[model samples]
Target: MNYTADSIDNLGISLRTFSKINLDTVFIYPTVANKPYQIALMHKAANNTYSVMDTYNGVTLNNHYIASVEKKDMNFFTATPDTNTNLGVTFRAFDSLVLNSVKIYPSQIGVPFQIDLKRNGTVVNSYTGLTDSTTQVVNLNFGVYPPDSNSIYNLVFASNPLINRDAYAANTSTIKYVPGVIRILNDTAQGKHNYFYDWKVAAYNYTEPVPVNFLIPRDTAADAYKIVFTDNPGAKRDLGTTTSLTVPDGLTINTSTDQGYYNYFYNWKVRTNYFKFYSPAEALTLFGDASKIYIDYPDTANSQNVMDYTYCSKMFTYLQTVRMRNTLKNNVAFRDNLVSTSNLAFTGALDAW
Candidate 1:
């Protein structure tokens, strides 16, 4: 790209002059393939003042000087540490380092702590119910899984996408954290490859089905008033409005007044569009039938049903046909795509990004 001068002369001449010999500077962006490189550009202005600016990765600056012109661009690269190597530790690999928050009466004195682990932005393991009451903190560790074979793990947080509040330091009021290293060794360990790379941390909560309960008030007009449920999460029909409301699969409602009071549980149910698969057994029970079963696909922003995939269809068809053939049904041969195998029974959490 060519640049123009600031002003034009009276005779339509340009204020700036161009040199016949062009000057150019080439900067190679340091990458995980090589190492992280922080580049800085330094230049001296016509007035002899010097300045420097960071040209992180993709940015590049070029300067040209012919006469006594002082301005010239200087570039240098600083290697960024490789952070996501799986340095042989398991439980600490994929955990969201949570800070403990505990205090005594009147004065809430507490200490903050943070753990850093590297991750490839795409694949992250999940751990639920990681907590330490005394520290008021927890981390989600992947446990023994090797870091991605790709070797280059991008900087990503395990929690909220908008804000990462994971890394922290001990303090009374506020705690702060920042990425420290790119290796996977333990800070205090004397063993080799016992290091760890720290990146920004984010707090994350997985999507879960809202629980609800229903209760029918002791209305004097004891008409046969049963809750006609349309579609409340997984409970297809209404749990009969009786004296004591018992929800088999847990409920969030407390009352059963339609006209006078609004049912908050029912309202919440209507708003919750997705439900969690409690266990692998639950998933098999719900989707074991030959017919296609619809499951919430959180990875695709919960848009596409996993059952709709061609691979899923083939697997189901194959399984069903095997049973059918054994039961004296028509024996027809077919092919199945090897790509559609599923080891995950429960759906993963929605993409935090």
Candidate 2:
């Protein structure tokens, strides 16, 4: 499986397999020195058309001539454009996927240019930057677009100053095409040019399997949970007898769907306390009493000056009987006055003492 060329695209590898075997890593050895190469996997259909499966972009000749490739969700296909023409390519996503970026070969470096990702002749996302290299990858802000069928996309390129110059790399001899992934519709400038640019269109498969897990509170009595999609309200999934839930393809967690828990406390508050005290009551009783107190106090505070008036009143009532066993052993009337005055009398007594 040795491919020696200045540039390669759509290189095929035939594998005859009878039993299921796992492919962990792919090793690619590039004889050329100091060159970067992209290795990708494409699946051939029964109709003899090919679609991108997975692509590895980190392959280069710098890693001791051996590039260990791993399967990623990214898929891309490249085409060579005409260097003499300032044209663009119109294509369509054969499957539902996120259009990640488009890498183009620019003729002039450091020149300002704009690349637009248009859907059905309308610009949806645009990338503007100074050309820095021969291969400039333009990234889009929108993660996904057209989200459905019947929508076509165009990758239009334009340079500043409006000069008739060589802006992109194109191929006139062979027009690269990947069905059900990316199919060339037409040329933006010339109709039916039968040529495509040296543009690398990369995308992530929307239906690609992504592993997901959900964690539920241990104290919650909800034996069943339901996950609802925000984008599609009608779509829902029920978690039965398991805390782990299944995430379907094309649905993003938190972004596209919202997880719901039934029979659980909706309004809950959290408080952190560093001081631990041993109580004679049961754990459940202590927990219940602690839940009612929203404000926490350190073990020692000088004169209760920092306490809020309302919270201080609540704390004084809760600790009134306990304080009676200490310095206020015989001061029942004083404790009552402290509570009635909203702990102001207690503050005055502490200041006087």
Candidate 3:
């Protein structure tokens, strides 16, 4: 692109391309000193209308070539102390940015001073400390400040003792700063025609979303379960189970081989083990049925004599007594043996009587 020095001094040149091209950086050389400039990308539609794609602001020419950059800007010049004791400036931002820190030239080194950043006359942040001769960057600590084209922001600088300071002002008796992403309007306390404190501001443009990579451990089990991500549609991945070893089948009790002993044992061990005690009513509900019993005794005429005994009535009477019932319930081994013997005898399978 070819442009004249007059155009570079007064108006910035714009070069249009026949085809679309991606731009990463832009370089500009200004003919004048201390002139503010901006770099922007514009898109032209079919209707010959232009829309801004991106913009970088608060840039100035200082007799050297500079590229369009973001995040930080510093403006400093040779200055002498003036009569002003307290200095402040008001500005507006056209885009979202974070105010990280501000650099100020202290009139009196090692003197206690205060800096206040206010929005709409309300102080949002404040910093008070002794001025340093080497560094004057006052950290704001406020993470991000939204863009407000209408609201005015005031940055105030004050000291305990009266001290003279030099500030930036126009020769035409006006605020002398260019309008860009961040625009300095005028002095807050003194107004538009007064001296405003020169400041170097550090800021950040809102960043774009970054792609993140997640490292997940592989599943090693043969029967590993998979988790499905429903939120990330179209980005689903079939990460197979990591393990190759098959899980052994759960151990099962063989009740038939154990003469059905395991059938009741399994029930008692797995189901009834959770209960600490069974109520008397519950025990009666479980084993309250009565069965016929034949009692055998020695008779005078015969070797064995069989007599029908009312065992149910006697058993009910014994169970009705709380002491007897508790004794049977507490002695689990005795109760199991008595139940086994009674079952064998009732079925005529008792071998040893």
CA lDDT of each prediction against the hidden true structure: 0.25, 0.37, 0.37
lDDT of candidate 3 at residue 90, scale 0 to 100: 69
10-87 in candidate 2: lDDT tens per residue? Answer: 322223222122223332323233443444434445665555555444423332211111111111233233443235
Cα deviation at 341, candidate 2, in Å, is 99
Instruction: Report residue 242 deviation for candidate 1 (angstroms).
Output: 37
Q: What digit string (tens of lDDT, one per residue) describes model 3 on residues 154-188?
A: 76654433333333343453333433346766653
Clashing pairs for predicted structure model 3, backbone only:
219-242, 219-243, 220-242, 220-243, 221-243
lDDT (10s digit) by residue, model 1, range 1-353:
01111111111000111111111222121111222222222233456443332232321122111111000111112112222332222222231223221110111113222233344434544422322322222333332232322343322223311111122222232212222212222221222212222222332221122222222122222121222222211111122232333122222223353323222122222111222212345435645543322233224223233345444333333334445444442233422211113312233333254
Model 2: lDDT equals 0.37
- Candidates in order, TM-scores: namely 0.16, 0.30, 0.31
Give me the displacement of residue 319 in model 3, in angstroms. Answer: 99
Q: How close is candidate 3 to the true structure, as a TM-score?
A: 0.31
